[model samples]
Target: MEKNFTIASLEFCLSQLKRADESVVRKAITSGDGLSESSDDVGQKLSEAHKNAVKQCLTNADKLATLHNQIDACDKVFERLQNMLCSFQNNLGTIGEDMKQLQVQSLDIHQELENRQKVRNELSQFVDDIVVPQPMITTIMDADPNERGFIEALHELHHKINLISSRGNGEAVAVNDTIPILENLKYKAIEKVREWLLLKIYQFRKPLSNYQIFQHQLLKCRFFYEFVLNHEPAIARELQDEYIDTISKMFFTYFKAYASRLFKLTMKDAASKEDSVGAIDTAKSSGISGFFAAKPQVRNRATVFSIGQRNGVLQSDFLGALIVPHAAAQNNQSFQFETLFRSLQLAFVDHYSHEYLFITDFFLVSENEALEIHSKAMARAVSVLLKCCEEQIVVNWDAISLHLCICLCDKFQQLLIEREVPDVNGYWETMSNILWTRFDQVMTNHNDSVRMIDLKKLQNQGALDARPHFIVRRYAELTSAHLTIAKSNGKEIGPKVGALLESSEDAIEQLLTRMSTMQTSHKNKHVFLINNYDLILGVIDDNESKQSRIYAIVHELEQKSIDDFVEVVLDPHIGFLIKFVTECEGLINQGHTQLLVRYNDKISTVITTFNQKWKQSIDAIHSEVMNLFTNFRLGTSILQTIFTKFVQYVQRFSKIIAHEVFSSNSACSEMINVHQIMLEIKKYKPVY
Candidate 1:
């Protein structure tokens, strides 16, 4: 087939070459006729040659057709052979693949069989190790011995039954059918073993063979006795004397935990002579106190302490009292009391949730237990509370301290009310007095330090940031607490403490007012320390109230402090205030307009004064640009005085000017045209 394909390829190549040869002869005959006088004769000869060539081509065509036929035959054979070879190879490949799959399948089956055999062997070996009927309790009414092989055979059958049952394979139906027979065998074997053990147990009682001794020994194993007694408790009683009864009871308790059957068993059903009181007594005497002691807070926690309060103290006494407790506690000579106070505060938070701080509940507590709980819990938990507050709970010094104090006072009042605390001539008076005295001392100390205001330092800082912020926050919360009491609704808040609340509130207000005055005085003193210091003090001394007295000193001192060339102290306070006024353009315009309208005639007078005093500054008659921006602030102020002036300016500038009657006029507007345009301008201020 390969040789035939080669012959066909050669024949095809030769036929193509023959066609090329014929074309060359026909081309030569046609071109010579067009080129010469003898071209006609030359063409005739060429034509004859062409004819000859054509005759040759006829012969070549016959050969070509024959070759084509031959090549077709060869191609047909080659194609058939290729088809056969391909079919044969495809069959071989399929057979090879099938054989490979069969080999893999066979290997898998073989491995599966090997695993099965191995599992079976392991199972058989496991069966061989079984000891037949299990080690057991002594039995008493038979005389026989079980053969070792027979016993082992029964054990092996039991194990096989178990294995077959566990797997639950439908293919193991044969094994399933045999389970009843296997179980029967097991029962027979157990019966036989029982008879044998009974024989051994009785036969060896004289000298006590190993079996008899083993029965006695088995009683000592808690589990062995437990097992035997569980199956036959009445039977166990028949074997029992005093010691056996004790062992049997212990066994029952063990079985209660382990088997969970016959649990909480009792001989009380037999109606014992002893009473149950002794048992109750034993239970009560068990070490429960020590267990409670391990957890002091569980025992000690309570909601007990409380107070009564009132408020005519808003903005003053209320504020002071709020601060006094915390301030005094922080400054206390006894760390213990301070710490206890802190702890109670934290306890109130935890026990009551955050609701306690904002709400007043009756807070009913049990007995003195509540009081004692509070006392001890506070003691136990205070140091920890403070420590946690220090590490993880930072508060705003002023805001929180103040808020917390008010909350504390509120909680204390709630406690008092719940406890039905009595007023007048009693423990309440003593406690109140004690608290007041301590508060007074703390306030006195705080004022002494606070009164020596450092105005120079304050001047270096802004109002809100002038001091450690807590001082202000605490001051505010305390003041607010008294305010809260006065505003409180309902009859819960007591009236007895009303005066005290008012006094505290007044004190807080006075203190703040006093501090403000002193700071003002100090600022005055500092500003004029270079000169007239005595004069400044004298001026401040004339004013009674703090701020007034201090401001009197400051004003004079500031005026006197200016340098010779400067007409003012050159302080930048006004500059900042002015900037504040100007930053918002609409606001500036609004303010200027409002102020101008307020002092309409006054502003005109002031402007006139300025114009007269500084002739060069405002010398423009209407010919000039009006120079609105020379004094920027003044110009803004002027806009306020007469908003229409701006309208006129823009109206005048925005018009078309006419310099002649009949000629093209200037583009800019004439003054009369400006007046006309002014009427059209929107005069209303735009909404921001």
Candidate 2:
């Protein structure tokens, strides 16, 4: 029943209750029966209301049945919807699981694609870096040697070889498989380059071949040498040795022939025993008193030392253009000894420089190894040059010519250094030692000759001249030449210079001694000493700093000679005045004023004698000085010096007479004044 009570049944019950109330109210109003007879009346009214209420209940029952049917229909529909929702939830869970699986699979596919692409790229790169193509093999095997294609192929082949040799890729089977093939190709390439280089090297042996042009050609293919050296060092060594041997022998043979022919053109009479510095001879054949009394018109040929005349020889380039013509002409024409020596040295230097550059440029070698190679290649050639130089040095007795040869070596060595040639110092130094040793021997011979000179014979052979002796003049010129060479070369004067000077001094001393024995007068001995000493000093004046030792000695000797000359000339004329003044000064210095006073008459008489003889004394001194010194200027210089000393002595004597001996102005009146004496001396000053 509660289930049947729908909204329609509850509304029907409410309508029945409202209708009963309405009927009761109508009955009370229409009958006006106040309920005074209400017991029976009310019972009948209640029975009628009950009948209406029953009918309305039956109608409500029908509506409530219909509403219950609709409710049952809604309940069935809701249950079906709930079952459908549960099935859908289960289906959605399965779909979500499938979607998650699909997402994971998609991610795996993306990763696999990326890894495959990476592997493909790596494989492509590996093949590109490792594979050798057929074109490369063909090019290496059969291309022209001079073509760019062969070099490119060779580079590619070497790259593959390096990959096989490298630590990281050496164990790869693919890389290992190609090694044997690459090795054969490399060997074939090496042989091709080796044959080419050997052919070029052999061309140097051809006569009249231009080696510098050949060297330039080799330099263009220098990479071939590097290739051979890297692949097979033994083959490279063999090539280098072959080049050294071929070049050495070629240079040796060429230079030997060249030098032999060149030496024949040298002057046979370039130097003689008469050209020696210590060879002293008189000028008697020329009707002169001293050896150098008459200066030769051709001064270059006459002098014992005259390097200035051979400046062309010193500065010669000795080029093949100049040498070859002279060698081929084979005329009777000849050069000086120094000219020959310089030509040989310069030619050798030019060849050595070229050879050094070639060895270093074309060979793949260490610096020391390159030097060793160069030395070996030039060894025989160097021996030829040294041997030629040795013969020249040993056979030649001309000291100046030998010295010039030494200078040539120095100059050539410096030229090589300037040209950036490799070290060939051993050769130059060896040649220099040979030259200097021979020079030393020649100089020693000269010194010994001077020391062992026959003074008596020399005296008997020649008359004494006012000029320097010929031997002294020759010694002076030789010493001057030595100093000039030393100074120009920026070197110190050697010990031999000192020995030469000592020997020269001995010679001059002997000369003066001979002159003293020949002359009876003290004046002639002083004159001879002065002339020789002055000549030496004048000749070496340009090299004073380098020849300070010799310069100082000669200077001192010259001053002593002048002093002796002045004493001998002046003593006879004014000895009394000088002695008197000297004695009076001494007495005055000793507090002997009384002794000086007693000598007043003597002083007056001395003044009278000086006043009478001063002019004659100066004139006589001038005549004697002019007679003694061959050089007029030298005579004037000595005369001026004598006058200066005489004036000074006169000044002292006049002061002594005035202050010490003569007490009165009248007594001082007779004294000679210094100005008057200087005025008289000024008449004799030299013009030039």
Best by TM-score: 2
Each model's lDDT comes to 0.36, 0.76
Scored against the true structure, residue 438 in model 1 reaches a CA lDDT of 41
Candidate 1's residue-wise lDDT over 1-688, tens digit each? 9999989978975685476566654675565654344447656998999999999989799798999999999999999999999999999999999999999999999999999999999777645332223331111112223333443444355456566557564644454465555555545544554443334334433331332244443323323223224333553334333322332333233222221211112111211112110111112223667565532231110100111132222222322322223344455422122222333343333332221211111112344534433333233233333343332112211211222334344554555565453211232233334344444443333333334445344444443221222233333334333334333422332343344333433443343444344433443322223122222223223222223323343344434432210211111212221222233234334554333223222323332333343222212211121241233332333323233433333332222112122123222222234343234323322233
Supply candidate 1's per-residue lDDT for 336.
20
TM-scores for every candidate against the unseen true structure: 0.20, 0.75
Worst 10 residues of 1 by lDDT: 298-307
For residue 305, model 1's alpha carbon misses the true position, in angstroms, by 25
lDDT of 2 by residue, 148-239 (tens): 88878877777777755763556567766666778888998998888888998999889978877878888987888888888989999998
